[model samples]
Target: MSKQRDYVLRTIEERRVKFVRLWFTDVAGALKSVALSPAEVEAAFTEGIGFDGSAIEGLTRAYESDLIAIPDPSTFKLLPWRGETEPTASMFCDIHTPNGEPSVADPRNVLKRTLESAADMGFKFFTHPEIEFYLFKSKEFGPDGPIPVDRAGYFDNVPGGTAHDFRRESVNMLEELGISVEFSHHEAGPGQNEIDLRYADALTTADNIMMFRSVVKEVAIAQGVHATFMPKPLAGQPGSGMHTHLSLFEGDTNAFFDPSAKYQMSVTARRFVAGLLKHAPEITAVTNQYVNSYKRLWGGDEAPSFVSWGHNNRSALVRVPLYKPGKGNAARIEYRAMDTAVNPYLGFSVLLAAGLKGIREEYELPPEAEENIWELSQGERRVMGFDPLPQSLEHALAVMERSELVAETLGEQVFAYLLRDSRQEVEAYRRQVTQFELKTMLDTI
Candidate 1:
């Protein structure tokens, strides 16, 4: 057995753990778990546990119902929320078919496949996400709307406040699970919190994001409040975003850095940014998957609407933050369009695919948009060659359907399932008579 596997088995026995939870995600980024006693874990690591793939959202058909969940020992971590005695630990699983082939419909597999392509090109992808979400008083909301845990705004110190206490517990739990957190603060919206996870390899970062969400929710429930990662849970407040910082490395050296280049960004970095800008519209459906996600994108509180890149400009789709004098490895670009509710695995996959395409094709970097693109008129933006991203989920899906890059990166199974699931969401949304329509037009019209 590998060292990680052996260590997991030894640790479980030593800790007196009673249950081990095998975790995975569906196409929509929802967490799923299957628990087994400590005895089954060893067999699970080898023969794998059988499950109904068809029951999972977009996993497979009933005819191909047989699937296996193979535990990734490296991800094994004890559930701190479950307390120390008879503790329940968890590990993320990789789904495979009975024949032992990786399932193409698996979002995790989709990302791994894309990362392999990057590996073949001599690049290693990394990501750091500033995950944002809201804390509500309860799951049940009144007509006025959900109640936030506190009214504190950006960086407001609410000592003894629920938000403050919640963050402390959440961060501690995350650290216990081996997830490194860089920063945590109250966001601009009331009761909204932002926790930034430190950079890691793209796959590990995705797994951390999955765990982060679970930890947040678990902490909230334990404290008698509710937490949500919904992109837009309020009418006028700034929507939650996951502004992801991305970089590529080549054998321990930052490939994006060059002291002599413009903005100290290397040619490879420039092309990667070019690729992201070019493909932002097409990939929007995956990064910002929900219909509500469009509200966060177009709602415009530091959210980028147009396809442009600039140094220190939050209004552009891709922002190359000002470079620190001595921090060469920190040189990276932040893609601002994605919100917090994304399927991280698929989201990272498409983003990496787009960026890699740029490097491979040598896409010419565009001139920086010094002026805030959001402040410009449509005509001015058009003149500057800045095209806007898709204004809605439906529009994004249409763009994605035509793009060979997104289709190829997602593979046929995942691509088709995502399209079907997204189309259903759009159609369901279209049929609904929203509260706005009733409040505005019912009496007047």
Candidate 2:
């Protein structure tokens, strides 16, 4: 056995862990777990635990249902929320077929494939996400709507508020799991909050994001509140977004930085931004993957509705944050269109593929959209060559259906499933009688 696998087994015994949960995610990014006894740990490490992949959404067909969940020893961490008594530990798993081939439908493998491409190009992808979500009084809602835990606004510190305590406990739990949180604050909506995770390699960051959501929800429920990563949980309230800061590195040096270049952006960095802008619309179905996701996108606020790039322009889809002089390593681009609800593994895969395409093909970066895009007239935006993003899920899927980049990045299996899923979502939504329709036309005409 590898030293890491041996270490995991030794630690489980030392910690007196009664259960070791093997974790993986479905195509929709929902966490799935299966517990193993200490006796099964060795076999799990060596041969992997078996599961029915057909049961998982977008995982496999019934004919090829049998699959293995190979536990990654390096991801071993004791579940802090599970309590010290009757200890429990968890590790992320990689899904594979019975024949031991990597499952094309496995989201993690999708990302791993993309990262390998980056590795071949002599670059490493890193991401730091500012994840945002809302806290409600309860999961159930009445005729009115779900109630916010508090009425606090952006950065407002509500003394003895449920949200304030929720953030504190959530961050502590994340730290216990070895996930480093960079910042936490109240966001610009009632009961909404933001937690910025420190930068890490793309794969590790994706794993952390899964853990982060679980930790946040666990903390919220313990505190008698409900948490949601729904992109737009309520109308008239700013929606939650995962504005991610992305970078590429070549060994120890930052590939995005060049001190002599304009805005200190290396040619590589500009190409990366160009690539993201060029393909952002096609990838929107995955990044903002729900019918309600469009409500948030078109609802204005700080969400980037148009495809443009600029230094420190929050209104642009891709923004280059100003870094301190000589802090080349800190330089990166923030993609603002993605919501908190996306499957991070798949989301990161398409993004990395897009950026790498720019690097490989040497895409030319366009002029910066210096003025507030929201303030510009549609004609003005047109003259400036700005294009709006897909306005709805239906629109996004249409664009994605034609995207060669996204299809090649996510693999054919996942690509076909996403298209089918999106079409079903749109059809179901169209069939529903919405409250807006009821209210607006119920008594009129």
Candidate 3:
């Protein structure tokens, strides 16, 4: 057995861990877990537990259903929420075929492939996600619609509020699970909270995000409240978004930083942002996957209607934050359009591929959107060469269908699966009779 595997097993025993859980995500980023006794932990670490992949969403067809979850030794953690006595621990798994080849349909494998591609070109993909979510008092579904737990406005620090306590518990839970929390605070919407995770390599960060969501939900339920990462859970409030910070590194150095360049951007940084802006429209369907995600984008409040980049500009889909006076690693671009609902595995893969391609082809960064994009007139926007993002899911999918970059990044199975699934979602939305229609035109027209 590998030293790392023995270390995990030894640690579990020392901690009195009665059960060891193997965790992984399917294509849609839902957390899935299965547990084994302490007796089986060592073998599980060396080999893997077999499961039927046909049951997992977008994982396999029944004909080729065998799969295994090989635990990532580096991700082992004893669960704090499970308490100390007769303890339980968990590890994120990398799926593989029984014969031990990495499973092609695995979301984690997709990201691994992209990272390997980046490594081949002497770069590493790193990402930080600013996760946004809402804390609701109750999550009971109603015929009318969903409702928020609080009436608090943006950043309203409700002293001893349910949300306030929930944040404390959530952060505590996350820390116990070995996920670092950079900052946690009330967002611009009532019942909304944003927790920023410190940046890490793209693969680990994606795993962290999946765990982050699950941890938040678990903590909320424990506290007798409901938590949701749905982007537009409430109508008037600003929507939840998973704004991601991205940068490339070569060994220990930040590849995006240059001390003497205009805006302190390296040629590589400019092209990377240019690639993001160029492909932003086509990749929208992946980042903003759900039908409800459009409600957040179109609701304004500077939720990005166009593709452009500027230092400290919040209105653009891509923003290059002003360089810190001396911090090199902090030099990175922020992508603002992605909501919290995306499959982070696929989302990060496509983004890295697009940016790497930009570096390879020398994509030129467009003029910065210095002016408020939401306020720009059509003619003015045209003059400035700023194209608006797709206003609807249908439009977003249309663009995605024709993008060779997206297809190549996602591979054949995922590209076709996502397109097919997203279309059905769009069709379902079209068939629904919404509150707006009923209230506005039901009797008036």
For each of the candidates, give the backbone clash count: 0, 0, 0
- The C-alpha TM-scores of every prediction are 0.99, 0.99, 0.96
Instruction: State the C-alpha lDDT per candidate.
Output: 0.94, 0.94, 0.87
Off by over 4 Å in 3: 141-145
Candidate 2 lDDT tens digits, 117-149: 999999999999999999999988967688998
Name the runs in model 2 displaced over 4 angstroms: none
- Please tell me which model should have the higher lDDT, number 2 or number 3: 2
lDDT tens per residue, model 3, 244-291 = 999999999999999899888999999999899899899999899888
Instruction: Please give, for residues 1-445, the per-residue lDDT of candidate 1 as tens digits.
Output: 9999999999999999999999999988899999999999999999999999999998999999989999999999999999976799999999999999999888999999999999999999999999999999998887879999888999999999999999999999999999999989999999999999999999999999999999999999899999999999998999999999999999899999999998899999999999998899999999999999999888878888889999988888899998779999999999998899999999999999999999999999999999988789999999999998999999999999999998999888788988999999999999999899999999999
Q: What TM-score should be assigned to candidate 3?
A: 0.96
TM match of model 1 to true structure:
0.99
User: Which window of ten consecutive residues has the lowest lDDT sum in model 3?
Assistant: 141-150
